[model samples]
Target: MLDVGSGTGALTRVLRAEAAGDVVAVDADPKLLDHVEGPTVVGDAFRLPFPEDTFDLVICQALLINLPEPVDALREFARVSRDGVAVIEPDNGSVTVDSTVGGESALAGQAREHYLAGVDTDVTLGSDAESILADAGLDSIEVTRYDHDRTISPPYDEADVESARRKASGDGLATDRETMLDGGLTADGYDSLRQRWRQMGRDVIEQMAERTYERTETVPFYVAVGQV
Candidate 1:
């Protein structure tokens, strides 16, 4: 099995333990590859350093969106795999962040939009994973949809909000920390958007837990599998 762009061996660890054959984890980030336990290699996704048909199965998660040339990377995966390949990626186009105040603060909204836009390359073909595999000459293509949702309770303090704010700022989504804090909706605004998300999270959790909140917040993903 081949785990491409296996960050921190999150999936690689599992594959290493479960698969009978060897699991080779590859990634461009040497830092992430350093801690991986299994047979690991640091390499570019576009140009994998492996012989043709070297793997029976190849699995890629949250990778396509980050690659500058996803199609080329897909072709490489297909080239390396002799039997099959599986890909999992988030559907950014379908991503929605609910807020109690109808919508998030303008800054928060812009930040979210920027975050999504920043990874456009990764998700450009998000909705077309199967098509990608087919175009690469893989057969028996099948696509499955998965949705994951999580909610946090009580621990929702100012720190948590601040942490999220920091992450958003650091991620280059927001222009600056102050803008987010000030609720100015500028790249620099740094006002707490926590209350808004907290309320939204609570509503979602209640609805999901009590079965009364018919509306659900979900993150959709696509899993495409095919035989080479």
Candidate 2:
């Protein structure tokens, strides 16, 4: 088995534990590959260094969402794997957020719209992986959906307190402003969005001060597998 873009070897470790074979971790970052157990290779997803059909399976997680050319990586994965290829990615467009704080949910929705519109990469490709795999000339394509539930509730922990503190600082809003700008948002548009985001963040912090802040998020991920 081969794990491409195996940052910190998270997926590689899982494959090592569940499967009965050596899992080779391939990453462009040598610092990350240094910690990976068993064999590790420094390689790019665009051009894997190994020969054709070098591994029985090739897998990646949370990689395609950030890549400019996901299909190119898929084609390379197919080229390296004799049996199958799998990619796990998130559907940022389908994310759902529920918050007890007033205005927080609406704010999240607005942010998501701008994010989907401005981002250069196909952030929604998790749901479209099947079609992408088919385009890559793979056969017996399969798609599996997984929903990750993240909840923030009462009796706040240290992390929650720190998170609320950070929200009050508007750091998240600042980061979003930068991302939106990089994604082609105009200066005036970013100012408008930032105003709303900061307002919502302040409201959230106020709710946290009253010990009433609670939120949950559902992020959908898809695993697309195909035979080479």
Q: Candidate 1 at residue 11, lDDT?
A: 85
lDDT of 1 by residue, 18-108 (tens): 8798999999888998889858998888888999999999899889877777767888988888889899887766665443323434434
Where model 2 places Cα greater than 4 Å from the true spot, the runs are 182-184
How do the residues 43-77 of candidate 2 rate in per-residue lDDT, one tens digit apiece? 99999999999999999999999889999889999
Error of 1 at 182 (Å): 22
Best by lDDT: 2
State residue 175's C-alpha deviation in candidate 1, in Å. Answer: 5.9
Candidate RMSDs in Å, in order, are 6.3, 1.9
